[model samples]
Target: ALTTMAKWEGGRAVDARAAETGETPLMAAASAGQLDCCLSLLTAGADPLAVNVDGVGILALVASKVSQGKRSKVRAVVRLALLNAAPQLRVLLLHHEDCGRHISFKPHQESPERISAILAFIAKGATIGLFSAEELLVSTEFDQASKEHLIRCHSEEYISVITQLGEQVANTPVAFTPYYQGFKGLPQAKQKKAEFSDTFFSPGTMAAALRAAGGVVHAVESVLKGHSRTAFVCVRPPGHHAGVDGATAGAPSSGFSIVNNAMIGALHALEGNHGRLCKRVAVVDFDVHHGNGTEEIARAWHAKHRKAGARAASGADESDLFFASIHLADDGAASSIEFYPGTGTRDDLHHNIVNVCVPPMWIGAGAGGRGSVSA
Candidate 1:
């Protein structure tokens, strides 16, 4: 009944009283053996905890039909009945993709309130130790491996539109000065700090969404060891469009389709190990999109090295080690985007992207070695 109720879209149910007193149509129909109606009502938001005419629950109503019972017997019977009711409960817990709605208000707000509403719930979960700081940080994984973002895979056109669209759907326009604002729907202090930080893309800027205090960003060391932190560690401006470089589906050819999270994290880790590290590492991508931009970064890294090698031949004592990235991809031509000469990207490439490509299965698809570098 609940499933049927939730699935109903063309027109509402005859007794769709879910909006009134919170008593959904599913709850009303599940009282009897209207199995079809029962399935339908359970599909919608129906309360099984509802009291019957004699103050008995629907569970108790159904439980009465079971075999004979005593104290433990009655208790076990109730548990069995409840456990068997999961099909009806699951519909209420999840909402699937909206193939029907032309537009959804899913990404509607950038204000603190919408964020806070979840935080309030998460805070309760945090107090009980059910959620961690990583869960609360609200940013991408900050992997050193992903620093060398290629511009080609993630085309400039797609990136610009996505960022613009993201802002249109998620940000509020404010000055980058003193970091303060008095918008009615937003907080003054946070808006101020965010406004100011948006101007700077360094270490702790909120624009980059870097939560350096204590976060999953440190998971770069072993994100692949576990399932939860497998996503790339995010560090600011949160590179949404970064890749190895290629053309998407029907879109024109572009750069890498990934942000060099792997490259950035790996380089940072490598530099920490020794000034002179391995000159080669391979990055294999398995994402649905191509990584043209990541390839662009590798190309740039190669160019810089050729120059550095030229300088070294002249006895400048420089070895700007260069590398390569291998992208395994399906074309997403429809989603291809090009990027502007954003300094953030240049800064990333100037510092990282030196490696090779391993066999496929890097991102959680198949079994392959987690990338490594020894001094």
Candidate 2:
């Protein structure tokens, strides 16, 4: 019922308070140890600070009930509600240390530069009173994603290969694939050769990748549980280029990406890792490059379960996975948007995928035959 109300598009006001008592829906839920109900109301824009006739807020009532059986759950509800009640939406910022150390010659694309720039932007926002530092909960403490979790979104073969390559990098600091050897092979005299690709991994790369994946999963849980309405996972090496197809799907050194962080997090959400069942999930990728890996993971999982659902009437069924990508087209065709990986197109649209094909330079139509430009 709460989900239906949340999805309702009609703008009709629902009375949150009673005629005489003035208690809110949130207060009632919190008082009863109904964490889910509290979350639902919070998602629907319920004012967490709504007070009753006695002048006690919903949070106070929830705190008063913390000594009950569902102590932790009630406390979590109160914390999440407090966060939501803030004037500005609280933001959780997570990053791994290895992200900042992963330097590259790719100018603005380097890990340290990019991560530092983002931190600076956040600091600026805080300094300007846009949001308080407490609202921006920054953390580096996240468990590394386990192999069991990784296998859920990636092929066994890909996982094995990436693991081997990461081990090699740890042991020897240099490894060779069919095309080229990683950075350790390049000498100080060969500075130009090292600038060729930023995707190469070192010994610590896998740990960083796992932590990055972990941060995103944690963020998703935080948001879904009403802990925070927003979270930003800032980590590198980037994973959108590391997908489930071609030679790079599971390869640790593919496109400067080691693990598909987005897909891993999505898998966690679907699997109810945080104890919340997400029947329908959508991954919107705004990266400049197409999120082929995320697309592959979502589609393949959906198809696998869908086939099982048809055969065994009572088995695990497929959940709806919506994958949308707005990025540079891979085709050189004269057409406005020529999709690569051949998965996203108007004719080939799936119930789960929506591809918005647009030209590289054509940044939407504007007045007077002018178009806004972006890099």
Q: lDDT per residue, candidate 1, 1-375, as tens digits?
A: 446436668335533544534444444444332345544444453444454445554443442333454434543444344335532211111111111111212332222243335546756876886633233223333322222222222345533433343344323332322221232223654443442232221111222221321122244333322222233332222222243322222222222111334444433333322232333344444333334344454555455556666542222222333333333331122123222212111122343442222223423344222223422
Candidate 1: residue 83 Cα off by (Å):
35
- Candidate 1 accuracy as TM-score: 0.28
Q: What is the lDDT of residue 86 in candidate 1?
A: 33
What total of clashing residue pairs does each candidate reach? Answer: 100, 3
lDDT of 1 at 103: 21
Error of 1 at 285 (Å): 1.7
Candidate 1: lDDT of 333?
20
lDDT score, candidate 1: 0.34
TM-score of each: 0.28, 0.64
lDDT of every model, 2 decimals = 0.34, 0.62
Off by over 4 Å in 2: 1-89, 101-108, 170-195, 245-253, 273-276, 310-316, 335-348, 362-375
Clashes of 2: 3
Candidate number achieving the greatest TM-score relative to the actual structure: 2
Error of 2 at 165 (Å): 1.9
